[model samples]
Target: MNIVVCMKQVPDTTEVKIDPVTGTLIREGIPSIINPDDKSGLEAALVLKERVGAKVTVLSMGPPQADLALREALAMGADEAVLLSDRAFGGADTWATSTTIAAALRKLGFDLIICGRQAIDGDTAQVGPQIAEHLSLPQVSYVSELELAGDSVVVKRTFEDGYQRIKVKLPCLLTTLKDMNSPRYMSVAGIFDAYKKDVQVWGLADIVVDEANIGLKGSPTRVKKSFTKGAKSAGKVYEVDPKEGARIIVEALKEKFVI
Candidate 1:
């Protein structure tokens, strides 16, 4: 089986900072890591590769620096890596991004595609489904468990209340949750081998997509403003008997119109 995993390099949110003047992320000097959910998806693909003798490829779209991210995937046991990078792909929204990725996927071909549920930077959770829509492929999101059947895949889809088991045929897309699997670490040998391997890079002209349907020109949404969340005030605390505490809590709820 040919498995393709969509991965992204995102700033570590715990270390992220906002620019007060520009209202944008302060990316300079910040460390970047694979998106957690995407890493889990890669782990899932690696597991399948080991079990069924599948060939795994990692795909990503970002700036030139994103090559580092692809190398990390190679170090994690992906057989190959491809990076889609171009000035023409700048300032793209989820729709344009998916269009470009889907076009590339068509050229690369795949029996299965795995993506993260959402990106930490955007938190939109829209790109994966958008890619499926563009490719006209069946997709299941929030997959917590995955197993291969005869020519089909069985997955456990997670929900807030519970989970549902689903069976989908081959050539389908799946968006995985971070809890799906624990990602393996890169070994010394793998790391050295990863640096030696070449990452195939493709630009806009390489894929068969309309120029008008990519980059900022094709994006339907624009950021009018950006800002960071404000700090919240501390909550009030009280030490009292159970009965008094109950009354105070009820009164507070009523005051806040939450009761």
Candidate 2:
């Protein structure tokens, strides 16, 4: 089986701080990590590799620094890694990002493509489906479990209420949920091997991308503004008996039309 895993490097949102005065994200001291759900997709790919002797390739589109994320995927047993990085690819919304990835996949053919349900930084959950749209391939999003069965793969697709078991043929795409599988930690030997491996970096020249849809020029959505919700200051503090508290809560609910 030939599998391609899409991965991303994102700032650790937990460590992300916002400036009070500037009302902007403080990225200076933030550390970057592989987007968690994307790692789950990699883990799923690795499992597929073990099950059917598949060769796994990792692909990511980001700045040149994103090569680090690809190398890390290599350390996790991916056969090859490709980084799509170019100035033209900068400031891309998910539409542009998925377009670039779809182009890259055309250059690197695959029997299956796996991606995360969503990136942590942008929880829009649009890129995977967008890639499927761009590639004109069938896709199953939010797959929690899967198994290989002859020529087709059976997937347990997840939903808010429950999950459905469906079989999809090869040349299909899947967006994996966090519970898809357990991601393995890189071994000492694997970590050392990653440094010795070479990750292929591709620019705009390497992939067949529509110039109008490659970057910010093609993105229709842009954050007009980003600001953290300011914390509410101290509210009214009333010392009262349990019965009085209950009455106050009921009145407050009625006032807010939440009753």
All models: lDDT?
Answer: 0.94, 0.91
Worst 10 residues of 2 by lDDT: 223-232
| Candidate 1 global lDDT | 0.94
Candidate 1 per-residue lDDT over residues 63-159, each given as its tens digit = 9999999999999999899999999999999999999999999999999999999999889999999999999999999999999998999999999
**Clashes (N, CA, C under 3 Å) per candidate:** 0, 0
Q: What residue runs in model 2 are displaced by over 4 Å at the alpha carbon?
A: 250-259
lDDT of 2: 0.91
TM-scores of all predicted structures? 0.93, 0.94
TM-score of 1: 0.93
Which candidate tops TM-score? Answer: 2
Candidate 2, residue 193: lDDT: 89
